[model samples]
Target: MEERHVIVTYRLDHATIHELCAQLEPDLMSAIRHPTGIPPLLQVLSVLHFLASGSFQTTVAIASGMSQPMFSNVLSRVLSALLKHIRSYIVFPQVGDLPAVKGDFDALGHIPNIIGAIDGTHVALVPPSRSEQVYRNRKSYHSMNVQMVCLADQYISHVNAKFPGSVHDAYILRNSSIPYVMGQLQRHRVWLIGGSLYYSPKKVFQIIVACCMLDNLALCRQVPFLQEDGPAGGLVASVEPLDSEEEEVEEEDIDNGNNVIQQYFQ
Candidate 1:
């Protein structure tokens, strides 16, 4: 008896293929040792999953049409290599290094004693079966606390990914490297801007100013200004403010116009 054979083909660009290969193990021997080449689609799929869904490996495997074992292996290999090389070099900012800060901000504008802005985002997670009580948040959802610090120019300076679901934002800031970094600002004019009221807000403003000076552009762009003729015939521009007075009057009328029955119903 004769066996049947099948072949398949797909379109791919060279640049994308190079990027895919870049995620594989760097050493030639390590690359050769894998009997199965890193399936191109798996590497791409894993990245998409992390970026778009933030799903676990098991969930991604089901969605990507690959077996669990294969998916796990592919994800592990890809993530390991990525974290080892790219993340190590790319993901962090120089916490205490003035020289590094100067270099990152020099061309944008001019200010001193600035690092980055910090904020926190929640990631959904499976509650720990053993410590389920601790994992439940105020909203009763299980999640992981992810804290990120970005500069005024929007470059992520730090990311603290290892924290419990129930950790408070202040608690995370207090316990992590953020406080230490801020604590070292005794002599420098540097500062950090955060939503934390407990921390020094004045210093945060200074940091934001420094960031703006370093970047040579406003941290955020203003709404496009309406063009108008200036006194000397030059173009003067300004933003239109929202009209909230009418809404306020309507609300007041509704409140005062209410009869006893309506007030009772309310």
Candidate 2:
């Protein structure tokens, strides 16, 4: 039997580290009030290492030569502090922030009559226990339901990540706080393009029903109404098991459309 030892070393980028340190101020302050004796950076490192590797907290702490309890405390505090401070900055668009619609269009090379695009993607997560039924998706895996709206410039304009994988895309859209801000006190019509999943009969009706409940919940505060019977109709469709041929066709169409959109924007 042969045993091998490997050593790896890399230079740390000082400027990037400094920026990260500056961002840690709020977390540092919170840590000082915490009973945990671990330093804020070490705790943050514990969390970063875990996230970067998707390892358990205990494993991360052991690999880092830190106590598990201290590491957990620091990770929790740092995450809470950072999320509290930076969430608003990273996850939303301003009111009236839709893309330009037909004004001096050709001169600026802007696509007229386009407001926004909506899409759903999956983010993988560690599988939880069976008790977390709502998190287990149809694929029998755990994931986060990620819904994103990007502008014509291709920047992520908004993100809705509060729902579990089991939740449908329509459900997230209906429950999101985005429509309230975008459609408040005005007839804001954003061009929504999505797959059948977004316009499935069950899903569309579900979103409509959810919107109604939300309206009632908020004393009839106007929310973005889904046009179930208009041009915006048939956005999402119910999930169905796809045959290989159908799946391949869908993939090819998606790839071709993505390339065209990318080239046009470029």
Candidate 3:
């Protein structure tokens, strides 16, 4: 075992990591024994190290005292198990829970009706063997454009990582089933603050608005690595011309939503 801080780099403490390993072992353990097979704990640790450091798989395998091939096999098994049990950990609040969700956001910044904040960040990846151009972003990087919506408490309420890096933030949301999910909630007006890239007011149920960078819930929670890189950098979408009716409705919603937070600062 490493130092406490080093252990924390995996994003969980030793006891918690061991508990997760124990839970997954029943489902992940081999039915027949191989004398040289890696233990489940070691397998989990190998994957965690790879993720936290973003190192090459071979490097992580060597560090974990296993061959690269074995490391890949173990990584696959651990990842499959985690995906199977993801729902137990990551959950979204139901429509009936909107009041409580709104209350949490209101307490943070006096912003009414804000259920969450949405944003997209690019996760860099090595170029694939074929059709690599599709993954090249505006910045000319090969990556995945991962969109996420986080609650006031910094827990991610929604995530869509299916898009390639070249896709725009608003396009991902527009194509996703999120609109359908939000439409199902017929009770209250819930809003999600986003950047210019997501400012499409016609999507009434999924209100996207331009917002200050530093004033987000994600920043307030002191997300590690943010201090190193600073705020996410991206191109701001140019404001599109709107019809008179649409412009009026958009302005009304923006003013009504942001006024309280502005007054609170005064």
Candidate 4:
């Protein structure tokens, strides 16, 4: 295929495509037939095309020179291989390097002690046979409520996607693993910026900020905002004072050199 064709179809250049195929080939080689089946490169290309375009299996199969069933099987195998190897590529920022995370947020909005931003978004999906009504959201559609935490640079630090669409964002956070982790690491004076849905004075110290404009800017710049669709509804601007207990903790941590505004990524 021509370079332009590769780029448009797979959203990757020829060299990068080849490099990815080479890396994935070892895991896929056993599934390929010697002469009758599709080549490994073609399988990778077909799967990439399907993913990039989000087209139906039948449509993608026609372009890939394979039957729909074969294309589906190939896609599943390729996805399985990628999932098996995903851990090597995706990792959260280390606990020791949190100061850098704070610095990045400070540069963006002068928000102090901000280690990350947290938000929940809905992903549209076909209704499941079981408990279909539970998946219907306020907008009258089925979805999965996915929550994510990311740094200022848009790197995701945590994610939880198990909740149904009808579940409230705050409820998801309250039931999530984040609170336990934060409690264990209470020595750090870190906070996350979130919208009204995540606001709770007693649950944790999440900064409630009007993030619609910042979210739009981040999306345009491809800043990896947690939501796959886009920004949630607009939020009214409001700032609540930090609790007295939190203020004391922050002062102690600052005295101990755990300054949340320390220079990061020097």
The best candidate in terms of lDDT: 4
TM-score of each: 0.51, 0.51, 0.67, 0.64
What TM-score would you give candidate 1 relative to the actual structure?
Answer: 0.51
Against the true structure, what is every candidate's RMSD? 22.7, 18.7, 18.4, 19.1
Rank by TM-score (best first): 3, 4, 1, 2
Q: Write the per-residue lDDT of candidate 4 for residues 66-164, one digit (tens) a residue.
A: 555566567656665555543444345567877887788899999998877899887555454677888788888766777888778665667676677
How much lDDT does candidate 4 score?
0.57
Among all windows of 10 consecutive residues in model 1, the one with the lowest summed lDDT is 1-10
Q: Taking the tens digit of each residue's C-alpha lDDT, what string does model 2 give over 148-175?
A: 6654444445666657779988889889
User: How far in Å is the alpha carbon of 62 misplaced in model 2?
Assistant: 4.7
Tens digit of per-residue lDDT, candidate 1, span 123-232: 54445467776656677865556677766456556666566668898888888877776667645656665651111222222222222222221122211222223432
Model 3 over residues 1-266: C-alpha lDDT tens digits?
34344344454455566667787887566621554345566666667665555445556656666555555556556665665554555456787779999999999989999887888877655445476788789999666777778888777667676677788888999997667767776457788877522211222111111011111322333433321244543433333222122111123322332442233223
The model with the greater lDDT, 1 or 4, is 4
lDDT of 2 at 202: 24
Off by over 4 Å in 1: 1-20, 27-34, 37-46, 53-65, 90-114, 196-266
Report the lDDT of model 2 for residue 24.
Answer: 74
